[model samples]
Target: MSQALEQVVAELRNSLGTIGEIVGISESATPRFELFHAPNSICSQKVRAVLAHHNIPYRSHQLNIFEGQTYLPANVRLRLMGCIALGGGLVTEHTGSTSVSMGGCDPAVVPTLVDWETGQVLVDSKRICFYIDQTAADGAALRPAHLQNAIDAEVAFVDNMPNYQMLAGKPPGEDHRPESRRKGNGVGFAMSKVERCDHYLAQFADDADLVRGYSAKRSKELNAAQQLFTPEAMRAAYDKAEAGCNHLENKLKSGDDWVVGDNVTMADLYWGVELLRMKNMAVESFWANGAKPAVAAFVDKVESIPAIRASVIEWPGAMY
Candidate 1:
């Protein structure tokens, strides 16, 4: 094993205070399904909902990301530093003749799926969710045949919130909080868990270069986000959210409690999580302040589902 991979394995083993568990999981099961994830990870939560929705069973390996576990060399080599094919497969092997660079990208972001039955190891929440929906015969169809386009559109909008970058510190947002306020409260508490990643990672002196680069980039992002709270930025955020709310309102105006049609679909799931995030950030005032009564009712309906509420990681203010 490479030093980085070895380090990750060691950390994984150490965190659980056990030996052979990681390797054992890899080796013991024939046609096994495994999911590597973190509890509070949004993507992870999304995948879990899909899995729960379908009643698909898999082994869960919840990584303690706050302890620098994800930065371990193995995780980088396996998860992030790999070639992800559009449909499903993740190829991490490096060819001697070609240079494959995945610098500064943490692939261990969570909710990685390994389906031993199909010999498929997939990363990315959307892809995994798609895989589950496509492969599983049971469960309510998340992507209904008639509503596919609408579902995709809703997922696109929810996942591509530019203003989300203002709060999340990234385009495809990851949780961002300051290390000093890890234990403190008031606002942005959700970010506290994700922010400690850099500090924990710095203890690995061998990865100093990578650590320094990440720290600098994080600082830059935080500074940029500070500016995103400006009146103009707030207006932009409000407008964007209003646009989404309007779309949802029109969809629900038909008297369907869900986004696309009478039944819950991927669109519902995507917006369910997105709405929860907005609520967490106190941005759901767009609904509460009487701007979109339809949307408000729609969100309430989505949240009332046992699968959505139980499967999704409930953030503060997420529940009704």
Candidate 2:
């Protein structure tokens, strides 16, 4: 941990009595749900968006990847280290770590959801969104029978593509280099990317600016793995995304207020957050950037909704 984060952890422990445990452990008897995530992670954003739409209260635990806190507890750390070795080298190391204790053994990525009551922890963003949709107090049925498969396919697509974009933008040899090459390189490289992106984002001064900056930097970095952001490639990706957006635009145009159905279902929340990411990436879209009248109208419509608007708006320093 950096001196800064170490200090933050120390102060938190002093204030809350334990380093890793939730704050105000005695506050209420209500079942608590905790989301472990990084601030600018898209998957994390998706989960938060759903929580906001469903009005499900949750505790947010910010994990610092640089500090290796994501692999806390000795066994998980070693297992992660071993996986890094077996994947033909450091390319695998760059992948995130997720242990069963943290919920599952898969994605090991952020936006992990833990239901404190049932001790059920789910890792994938889509699955967690479904859980919230089916279980939250305000859970309204949003996926129509005709559109369920389509919406599910879209969510799955969104879940996987952002990570590919992130990996594609990195310096060559950085992601797939040998572990020896990264002995002291991982944290520094990650932090430097963070700084550069922050610098670019300094131009914007509003909450939207922060969101845009963070999302843009992340998209750029994830796209580094391929190291090729040629216009053709970007356009191709944008074109595919545009199709998804149009599907949504048509849905909205059909007199339904949201993408999946009449209500703001998990489908709406999922696509809404994903579109926010695409918008930040400056992907050409007919609806969002005034490129398409119907699409732009749909963007306006969703943003006008109180819950959806509130969910996408950034809260910089607020914990949780």
**Candidate topping TM-score:** 1
| Number of backbone-clashing residue pairs for each candidate, in the order shown | 3, 19
State model 2's lDDT: 0.49
**Model 1, which residues run further than 4 Å from truth?**
1-31, 64-68, 81-83, 86-108, 162-235, 313-320
* Tens-digit per-residue lDDT, 1-320, candidate 2: 23432343344334333334342233654436766665556666667777676666666666564444443322122223223322322121122212122222322235566566765555556666777777766435445456779677656545544233322332223344233333432334444554544553454435452334244334534433333344444345445556666666666667765665566665666666666555554453346446566666655555665555655555342122
Window of ten residues with lowest summed lDDT in model 1: 94-103
Q: What TM-score does prediction 2 earn?
A: 0.58
Which residue ranges in model 2 land beyond 4 Å of their true spot? Answer: 1-30, 64-108, 142-147, 160-235, 284-290, 317-320
